[model samples]
Target: MLKIQNLHKSYSTPQGPLPVLQGIDLNVARGSSLALMGESGSGKSTLLHLIAGLDQADSGSIQVAGQDLGQLSESQLAGWRRSGIGLIFQQFNLISSLSVADNLAFQARLAGRHDRHWQAELTQRLGLTQLLERYPEQLSGGQQQRVALGRALAARPALVLADEPTGSLDEASSNEVLQLLLELLDEQATTLLMVTHSPRVAARLQRRVTLSNGRLAPADGL
Candidate 1:
């Protein structure tokens, strides 16, 4: 559902122009899951940002669900992202003042595709039924993460972009959350592109790709 061709991104550091992503070429099939694995500062998050339209690439073409992101204006991109992409960040990024229910429905409402039944089911499945009226601070880390996951998936987006989703959790909680996410994705048939540093997490995905020195490293089996 997503394709990147000759992608390049760089920044002007004191040392000179430093490349964060160099000629990254990737293709993610529809309804499939891909794990983006790399070290610190290896451009995993940068690439995700570009894919989500949060940041523009210095060069190259990015196509998600047959739409070329490079061609969209800023406002167009914003609308496209809101309607087409579900983003899950390492930090929950929940609104401090909003209740869990409101947070879950925020993006779906913004996209004008909020489905009451589906949202209720999501809340129930994420174990958030009774906690709907609570604020972010009132929930545990795992619960907050589940709420974040719900918020992202509530829109039924074509593509899901997750960056270090389990980065802040302990091993047990991370494993639980990852398994839950995978199961949810399978049930929803959602296409996922997740950036994670853990080998176990990557192994759970259908395919894995790593970034090295601003470029895609050779796939383990390909």
Candidate 2:
């Protein structure tokens, strides 16, 4: 579902240009999940942002679901991201004023693929049945994360990009959330590219890759 070739990115600093990703190449098959592991400043998140069309790469290409992201204009990319991709962040970026149910259905509605049946199923499966009427501030971190997950998957997006999704939860909660996420993704046949710092987390995915010094490498021997 995702392909990258010769991808490069850099940022301007007072000192000079600082390279984040250098000539990165990666390919992820549809319905497959891959873990991206790296140290801080290794460009894991940068790659994710580029793929999501949140940021432009300095050079090279990113293709998701056969669409070349670099070719799309800003408006086209925004529309594509709304319908084609699901994003989960560590911060649980839910609307403070929206209730759990509203938050869950937000993305699906925006994507114009909202199905009441599917949303209800997701609510039940994610254990958010009773929390529907409550706002995000009323829930605990794990509960909020579940809501975020539900929101992302409620749209049945073709590709899911998660950035340290479980980073804010306790160990037990993290494990539970990750397992649930993997199970749902598998059921939906969605492709996943997750960035995580934990080795244990990376080991759970079908494939793993690591970034080091702005370069991509297999995690096999890391």
What clash count goes with each model? 0, 0
Q: List, residue by residue over 33-86, the lDDT tens digit for candidate 2.
A: 999998988889889999999999999999988899999999999999899999
Q: Tell me, by lDDT, which candidate is best.
A: 2
What is the alpha-carbon lDDT for the whole of candidate 1? Answer: 0.92
lDDT of each: 0.92, 0.95
- Worst-scoring 10-residue span by lDDT in model 1: 213-222
Candidate 1 lDDT for residue 38: 87
The parts of candidate 1 lying over 4 Å away from their true place are: none
Deviation in Å, model 1, residue 46 alpha carbon: 0.6
